[model samples]
Target: MSTQTTQTTQPMRTTQTWRLDQRIRVTGGEVAARVLGEGPPVVLVHGTPAWSYLWRDVAPLLARRHTVYVWDLLGFGDSRTDPGAAPSIARQARTLAELVAHWDLDAPALVGHDIGGGTVIRAHLVEHVPASHIALVDAAVLGPWNTPFTEHQQQHADVYRTMPPDIFGDLVAARFRTATHRALTPESAAAYLAPWAGSEGQRRWLDQVAAVSFEDTREAVARLGEISVPTLVLWGEQDQWIPLSTGERLAAAIPGARTATVPDAGHFVAEDNPADTAAALLRFLA
Candidate 1:
């Protein structure tokens, strides 16, 4: 397969959002990432089952005033990873730290959603990367996050990987749909589905699903108060995956951390309410 894609570059804020058209070498695999605009640095990390594409709507807005970098975590998106490699959260955090150091970023501001939130938190508290500021949108910061389905997938990943292609696609589509309050448009659904449509893709997708663990968050939660950098805890008020209550508890744990609630949004706040999400981030960043 070709390493690059045929996508025409467009200006920020156009209907054609920026794409992750480049690959950066990382520890276990190459990560798909993109950089747009220029100024103070800001890195956007996406959570599991989603890629840097999740930031398409938000990155451009931030890029208007700051250099923005968005990347797919290992084992997701165009970032190819060895199926034999463990897809644990620590591995994801290590990859995030590697990318930040690879870019020679100096205390860049970080914005992360879902498991991406845990990755950045681990990068900051455990990996010792200095982030000027952090914004966690419905982050999985607290422990005991695995659902029954996820636990079963992890325990029987081999069996799950053998699912029929059509069945696998339907299952993922259904789960992705639940993350948003608004129904996913065909185009949006296709964008999220593109990375995990085929047999091999389905196997890797299961690997990621099975990789979700509480250990990473358990470690980060213990040190939440040590984060002295300015922080913002943004959440979708109607989040079903990680509740708004979790966001509130996280905000309370971090000293001087401010909270912003995005009304009418679900776990996928960027997809559901990018305007309010962007506005909250911009306010906190300022």
Candidate 2:
């Protein structure tokens, strides 16, 4: 089985590793998470094809001011998987609520990217989530939004059902760019793909990708009007996956919400524009 573990960085700097050292066992799986520091909780949820690791930089920065929680959704990161099954984002959202209750977080603020944004919204529908504010990073809220490459994305997700380990890694490395679509160092790129090693690992990505139904997601996106908390909309100006128009449409649908465009960042705004992402968040939360 192919397991992509971290490459040791030179142990000689003031910078510290955000060691992988936490877990939360929710229904359907035991999620791996990274938690550190302390204050009123801020939950950070990652997008598809990525795990808790994606929040490495953003989580720590937020942690300095609040108890930040970032975790892998079921079937992603080190979380368990069930082949041929793609758990709906609704289920993922429920699991998220359960996790929050387990942690005893009251009135926690939420920040989510991609589908994570949708999950946060849906969680609110379930009632009394202790949510103070909700933030979206290039959220896919304007639905019926199957971009030009949507079918192509589906085909690649389908291939995971049978691709060899090395081939799967190579394929993911090439296609992952489609998500972030930025210049990633070889090591940095590999670290993101490492969690999905081997057949079982490869299946996880496939299941989640296939689950991204445009019809269902559109219906959910339309429900944004139900959100009753303070909302912040942050989008990457260079994002190629979800259009800027979609972001604008989302800001309009959600009452009292506003949008900020990250000048240099793309879909992976947190990593590409960490400081700006943090600064905006700090202000929003404050």
Candidate 3:
């Protein structure tokens, strides 16, 4: 897994492409992540039911001036997940600690989305992982997540446990272009869903989501300030995933964290507005 992976490029061309090249086996499970560009390490951790593809645009853009690394958590993308392994925030943080250690990353900056934010926060809290900086988009951390899931969402999650693979895959793929991120082009939509299609990895994602306990997530949210790193908070003003008020509270809670509301964007901030998202990130990471 040490070999470099040449990633895909199209309308938004990178100087080059890198495949899902690196592999790190941690605690009896293998974690797969892709490394691209050349400079200091920046790890991008994707949120629920998504892989590194979530950062396709931001990865290449930042790679223009810095090293970019995107990884599939053990239960998502091409990464391996043990069926019996715990999928809680604490467990995922341990897995993340394994990832940073295996790569020998010293003080690597991290960008985490959705559930990934909670993962990184817990890693900082319990593992004391060094941080150059951290950026959280939408409602990644668990606080205020008690807002009700739509009836459609509840039905869908229930259907997922037993849905046919092809149809279920289509549903997963469709999430990239839902009413959430209206600015996504067809190509961009297809690219994000590509990795989750027809893979056992997708099933593991469903498993993890089904196992989530709202109460436990709330408990984890209470421990967030254990994260001492400088933090940047970006919220989509139009985001339906979580309210903007939550983002305000999140920023105020974390020392030195700042919040920027991207107008007209949703939870998938980088896709709907790549330039704004990247610019905001570059400024914070600077």
Q: Which candidate has the top score in TM-score?
A: 1
- Compose the digit string of candidate 1's lDDT tens values, residues 72-170: 888887777764776677888888888888778989998889888999999899988889999998888786666566777788887778889889889
Alpha-carbon shift of residue 228 in model 2 (angstroms): 2.4
Span of 10 residues, lowest total lDDT, candidate 3: 9-18
Query: Which candidate leads the pack in lDDT?
Result: 1
| Per-model root-mean-square deviation over C-alphas | 3.9, 5.4, 4.5
Kindly list the per-residue Cα lDDT of model 3 for residues 185-222, writing each as its tens digit: 66656555655556454566566665554544565567
Expressed as tens digits, the lDDT of each residue in 1-286 for candidate 2 is 1122232334211113444455565665666665677987899988776666677777778888899877778777666644443556766777678778877788789888887887777676553466999998887556654544545657765555766777877777776786664687666676677767677667666677676655545655667787778899999888877877888888888989978888788888876788888889988998
How many Å off is the CA of 62 in candidate 1?
Answer: 0.7
Q: Clash number for model 1?
A: 0
Give the TM-score comparing model 3 with the true structure, all chains together.
0.81
TM-score of each: 0.92, 0.86, 0.81
> Under the 3 Å rule for N, CA and C atoms, how many clashes does model 2 have?
0
lDDT of each: 0.83, 0.72, 0.69
RMSD of 1: 3.9
